[model samples]
Target: MPTVRLPVPSGDVWARTDYETLPDDLPVRVSLVHGNLVLNARRRPVHQRIARRLATCIEDAAPDAWQVDMDVDVLLDDDELEPSEIAPDIVVYSAEHDLYERPIPADLVALVVEVVSPSTKRKDRRIQPTLYAEAQIRHYWRVETDQTAPAFAIYTYELDDATGEYVATGVHHDRLTTTVPFDLDVELKTVREP
Candidate 1:
């Protein structure tokens, strides 16, 4: 038999693959959305504030059986991001889930949240929701920061059983008060960007 070598590219073909090049101390965010490289925006204080605040609020409001986590991997597929196996800003799962294992299963996740940024709007507003819905996660939340105001626009979605798509459950601009998975009362306007 003749020896042959496949002509493979030099760099990683996936966004998550390229994400490994980032330095550990770097504050940048990255997501591999369906074999495409979606480089996240420079870290904005407002973005982080929303994500952090929501995590705390959800944890406080959720039942003891539900666990809310931040920046944890939720894998639906081993490689591709179409059936997007990527991380959400925060994921709420059950206490019985095996946290010890890497790449937490999406079925165990009840909710997935994405804090919208200028750079991540398409993914957060559209792409990720489809993926989350396809994964059959019950809830999805998006927090959008205003350009001029010290406030956030939040949207809550519930998966539609018939279509397996997200249905808008609620939309909040002044506050994040809700009673879906559990009661949540977060003052969106007061969340400091600093």
Candidate 2:
């Protein structure tokens, strides 16, 4: 006997509800970007592994700091408490604030990292980075899997408070070493490997 398949909804069919109403067990990763629901499937093995390794490196470097996943929302409000948000792959938030909270402001974030997946490459490279910068996020890093060069392209962004925006300070093609908040060094090649 032949089996029938049901039709699935197309083009962002997820329910539009308050982010707080989202169930804890929801299978997909969800975030609100300008009132638009952005739902994504679970990360591929490569992406997950990279995120984990990068998290470890940052933690090792900044022991007192907090590193969180894209599940946590970062709010960017100009006047009212607008929850225009984005969940980055990895975020290092300030140690001064309440780490366990929802919708942490972009100003409180120290670093935001996005691992480029083939499916979301355009969004990751173009849209997300630009939005993060506009939100005045201090540091933004773009990690790309370099099969040809065997290293990741780590780009660091610095925020100019006077302009209320972020600027690309440096693009490190080699292993990255930093002393911005604290002394730390990490080899991009090591993190890029399988």
Candidate 3:
């Protein structure tokens, strides 16, 4: 991936307005985290492979009413100055919504998956899950990849409506089978294959 310049915001914090108004042709990739504009680095090939594979599997199994999208921002808040907008590795949302919409609202999102990377381990494991739960997204999956091989550990969580938090539903190693949002069964190791 080639480098591209990130836009500079006038205020100390990068507001939602700044991110929303970026040039259409800008080559950079970024995500707004708690009011900060986080410039994303190019992902490792293994990371990309896993994300693409999981997305494909999810889309194949998705029902007619649902759609799968990758690296798209899901709006968790609308505050102009301190909004929280996160772009998960993969998102499963309602098909009724327009795909071109700038940010997919949290309400329409049924599931968000994060393929953990060294740089994003903390955020993916802790911060992101918290934000998704707070937004009431029904399901979440954290994929832990072993750089040495195709081995993976997939952890699935379902929102506990009463506590406004996620409760562990399953911890998968060889296969990921889930029955929320829709039924899905993915052979976890296939994610690393060419």
Tens-digit lDDT string for candidate 2 (1-194): 35423223233432223555666666667666655567776788888888888877887787576554544677754322234667788888877667677677888887888888777778877888777877777777878776313556877767787875667767776578887645779887778778
Better of 1 and 2 by TM-score: 2
Clashes of each: 1, 0, 0
Instruction: Order the numbered candidates by lDDT, best leading.
Output: 3, 1, 2
RMSD in angstroms between candidate 1 and the native structure over all alpha carbons: 6.9
Instruction: Output the worst ten-in-a-row residue range by lDDT, candidate 1.
Output: 1-10
lDDT for each residue of candidate 3 in 90-168, tens digit (9 for 90 to 100): 9999998897786999999999999998888888899989989988999999988885326668889999989999999
Misplaced by over 4 Å in model 2 are 1-17, 63-71, 78-82, 147-151, 161-165
- The superposed Cα distance between candidate 2 and the true structure at residue 18, in angstroms, equals 1.0
TM-score, model 1 to reference: 0.77
- The lDDT, on a scale of 0 to 1, for candidate 1 is 0.74
Candidate 1, which segments miss by more than 4 Å at Cα?
1-28, 78-83, 148-151, 190-194
Show pairs that collide, candidate 1.
81-84
Model 3: weakest 10-residue lDDT segment is 143-152
Cα lDDT for residue 173, candidate 2: 68
**Candidate 3 residue pairs in backbone clash:** none
| Winner of 1 and 3 under TM-score | 3
How far off is residue 32 in model 3, in Å? 0.9
Q: Report how far off residue 35 is in candidate 3 (Å).
A: 1.7
